[model samples]
Target: MKKFIMKKKKILIVLMLALLLASGCSTNDTKNNINKLEAENRLLQEKIKNLEKELNSYKKESKEKITIYYIKSTQNDFVLIPEVITIEPEPNMLKAALEKLIQDKRNPFPKDTRVIDVTVKDFIAYPNFSREITKLSVGSRGEELAVASIANTLIKFPGVEKVQILVEGQTVETLAGHVDTSKPLGRNETLISIE
Candidate 1:
């Protein structure tokens, strides 16, 4: 009977030691998990704060008015006048400007002219348009005037030094089979009518 009691005690001690080790490991894992979660939460909070700052700055800029340059074609198709226009405010300023420019009935661009996409990188503007641009009745003088007009108008925007016109998201040799548009073009102020 004494031996039986000693064996039972040994079993109890071993069970207690196993339980202690298991609980200790569990507690350490829980602590590590909690610490990792806390770090992730801090990173997310910082990102939210930065996004809030950017939103506030954009809101302020949205209230500021912007001026856009446009081309006003004269009765002579070869001549164009540079005109300045202003709008209250818009998120996409360049897009808005282009929309207004196409609205002018005097320009060679059709009333249905559409801008597919526009992006500015490294001070260059890539304006993708529909194939209607190539459908126009084009002459050397008319092409020169129209191309220069659009290029000059786009360059008026801050940070835009040159423009590369695209059609259906692909580069073209020329918009009207006249000007060499195989590459991006800069503003040509000389094309604007002095008047």
Candidate 2:
């Protein structure tokens, strides 16, 4: 009977040891899982912070606004002339606005005589005013008057840093006998000076 009790005690001790080892192994697995999850969480937080910074920069850039100006001539019955003018809108919007202005019949200039090949790049207005020359009455002082009138008028637009007149896609010697059409024009507030 004593032998039987001794053998039973040995079996119980072995079972307890096995149970303890299993519990220890489970605790180690849980700890490893917790460490992996913590690392992943930290990485995600870093990514979120970087994304927030980029978003803030974009917002700041978006908040900046641009301004532009438009100029028109009184002698030509308030016709819009090509001159150094600042335009407030973006390039696409400026193109659309100019096109709208050209199409408006209420505009003073003759429909066919109007020049619409103007482009605004980097706040500089490139006015292809040479096309209007073909429509002008030949040998008439009207051509010179018209060039000056146009240049003087366009300088009124907002944000126009400068104006470059292109004749048939090339720079010309002069628009009339007075204003030098070779160089790009700066904003001239007074129309009389353009002559």
Candidate 3:
């Protein structure tokens, strides 16, 4: 489409130049017209270059993808499943990733699981969850899977190296009494199928 428009513009410019040549105007007037057309052509070329550059930049940004972790059962037990998704760059990217992680209802976590708050400092993410997350009855395996899911998801963010889970602003020992939650948790890639 751009090519077609450019062709039409070129033909119009040619017609304009032909008109100027045939008008039999004074030499000074013809020179001014040529200069004016040249300036307009330059502007058009610059505009097209800027548009192409913006288009390439948009394509680059759209191709970017982010990984989110969800709990999925393999053979023996539940594990963290990595899912690739695209999100616009934002200040609250950690919170957005956690929100995506909560969308999978089939995971070990309860359906009402949600991220209440998130903060990052020194490469550590403090992600607080709703009380609904800790009330699941899926046993120790479920609890561990839940923790791994949250930890793995947070670490996918740029600056988050570990995650500290909180429930209503207090760090509990465990979400379901399976894994230790008194400290910040790092990514547990070994728990996943890795395929």
Identify the leading candidate in terms of TM-score. 3
What are the C-alpha RMSDs, in order, of all predicted structures? Answer: 7.8, 9.7, 14.8
Pairs of residues at least 3 apart in sequence or in different chains that clash in candidate 1:
none
**Model 3 misplaced stretches (Cα beyond 4 Å):** 1-64
lDDT of 3 by residue, 1-195 (tens): 999999999999999998887775677788999999999999999999999999989977775467877777677767777888887665677877787777767566677878888999899899988998788677877777778888888887788899999888889888777789999998887787675
Specify the highest-lDDT model's number: 3
1 or 2, which is superior by TM-score? 1
**Best-to-worst ranking by TM-score:** 3, 1, 2
lDDT of 2 at 18: 94
lDDT of candidate 1 over 68-115, digit per residue (tens)? 334455675455676666564766777777766667676677767787
How far in Å is the alpha carbon of 34 misplaced in model 3? 32
Better of 1 and 3 by lDDT: 3
For candidate 2, the per-residue lDDT at 80 reads: 27
**Candidate with the larger TM-score of 1 and 3:** 3
- Those runs of model 1 whose alpha carbons end farther than 4 Å from true positions after fitting are 1-77
Model 2 per-residue lDDT at 168: 73
lDDT of 2: 0.56
My TM-score estimates for the predictions, one after another, are 0.61, 0.37, 0.64
